[model samples]
Target: MRILHTADWHIGRRLHGFDLTKEQNHAFEQIEQIALDEHVDGIIMAGDLYDRSMPSEAAVAQLNQMLQQLNLVDKVPLYAISGNHDSAIRLSTGTPWFKSTQFYMYTRLEQAFKPVELPDTQLFLLPYFEPFAAQQYFNDDSLQHLEQAIVPIVAKMKTLFDPNKKHLLVAHFFVAGSATTDSETQLKVGGLAAVPAGLLKDFDYVALGHLHGKNALHAKNARYSGSPLKFSLSETKQEKGVFIVDTEPFKITFKPLTPLKNVQQLTEYFETLEDKDFYKDLQLDNYFGITLKDRKPIPNVMARLREIYPNIIALNRADGYETNVEGSGESGKQIRQKDPIELLSDFYKQVAKDDLSPQQIKWAQEALKIAAKRESK
Candidate 1:
């Protein structure tokens, strides 16, 4: 069977303050086109269908439209699982409806034993789960680590797995030896979260998620279909795409997805940025993280840059400029002058090394308000 492996859709994700709805929709279209062109029998999405537990209406609608095109229109079987970022209970809705169609979605731990049987293959879907949940489900107190927690689940699947046929494991976890980026949240499950690749080496193919790079893990048959779009400035060099695997002959090929806008970095003064001819040849539609070498901020800098490069996502001062802000020198009490929300946001940026998403900021603001009210009382 010819199958396409993809993961980490993060459908509702935003880059800093920039909404990525249009870019996300474009990427979905490309996936649909790939499915149609490849004529794959099935598509396996490892996990993380959405960027957050509670997605916006527009994000939900985008997913609905894409699923309609892939499952109903193209008529390819889709098997997906919920990842760490997903709310398992919420994603479990419409289970009966999904099973009736070519869609198979798994969110709970018990779903691992039952494989999705195909013509000559068996697919085991394992969604993201906490170590405590796994321990309770199995009633095994000895399950102190992630690998130990998964051991019993894999043992159960082994009994049902047909060695005569091709077997694939679609799961979301941090496998040992996988390269990690800042975009990933460290799952502090028992403080031991990495699972050895050797445990999954028996499967014909292992389609994984939770790691953002395609080659995050180095197992023989395991690979990550990295996030379709770049999520962080740290991932600027990643080649985003999906993996195509042929089961019969056991061959795998990677097909890169055309990004809506490439992510690049430019460090120069305002004069260098004004060299329109230089950047025009480099494609203005690409997203950029600009660094200003000038001593002071330029007036209407973003406005002027947008006229040439319309997709700038981030900008900051280069070296030798310290304003006691988040990225500036860390020895000043300038943050005390800001409001509670701003101070909290700056602190978060300092720790996380990335700006908080709009949703996170909103939640932080509400929490700060509650704290302030309590103090007033």
Candidate 2:
């Protein structure tokens, strides 16, 4: 049987205040096409369906539409679980109806032991669980860390896990030796954060998530599908896609998807950045993190760059060119070059990565005036 493994959808996620709804929709379209083209028997989504615990109405609509198209219209079986980013209570709202439609969502710790039996494999669903919660659920006071908490759980699953059939563990957790990106949320605390690779070495296939990089961990047959689209500049170099696995001999291959817009970083001097030929063949419309090596601050540098790179996400100084808060080339100087209003505006544009609204500008001006009056006294 052929199955598709995907995770960290992060639907409705945004980048530096830029709405990513359209890009996410475009990625989902590719996923649907891939599923149809591959003719997979089942799909496994490990976790982090949404970017946050509380998603917007539009985000809800987006997920609902995809579910209808996949599980209902296409009639493909899907096994999903909630990550730390998801609100288990919210995602489990329509559990009964979803199960009938071949969309099995496991969000609670109690549902971890249940297996979604496919024709050739038993897919075990293990959602993200807190150490404290697992300690209470199993009534085992010895559960001090994530691995410690999960050790007994997997031991129990081993009793139910059919050795004769192919076994797949669908879980959201950090495994040892996995590379992480800035976009991923930190779910573990203290020393017991990462689960040992040996813990899941026995499974035929382990589809994991929470780490937003594929091939991130060192294990027997485990893979992280990663986020479909780049969520941070750090992940710009990652090749985001889904994994297709065939059960009999246990084979896995990646199928790439082109995102609607790319996340990238550009490092160059102001003069080089201004030359149109510098990025002639490059796609100029992508979201960018820009760094300038110029030693002195350029007047209206951000404004000038925005005229060309409209989707710029950050304006930063390159190594050895860091400036003081007042935009001075040297440090330890009084921040008096620019007034409070100009400084605030510059800060807003750099951090927000977008132009401030009229209301924001007004607030800044009034607040600066109050500061100026206080200074006069």
| Model 1 lDDT per residue over 1-377, tens place | 99999999988998877888988888888887888899899899899998889988898898888877888888889999999888898888787698777799999988887899987999999999888888888898888878889888888888898877899999998888887766554432424488888888779999998787797776779998888998888788899889899988999999889888877888888788888766767877788988889765355678887887787888788776546553355555655666777777676666666788999989988888898899999
TM-score of each: 0.81, 0.86
Q: Which stretches of candidate 2 lie over 4 Å from their true place?
A: 183-192, 320-373
Report the lDDT tens digits of candidate 2 across residue range 329-369: 43444446666666667667765667778998898788878
Total clashing pairs in model 2: 0
lDDT of model 2 at residue 160? Answer: 89
Error of 1 at 16 (Å): 1.1
Clashing pairs in 1: none
For model 1, what is the error of residue 136's alpha carbon versus the real structure, in angstroms, after optimal superposition? 1.9
Each candidate's lDDT (Cα)? 0.84, 0.84
RMSD in angstroms, all models? 9.5, 5.6
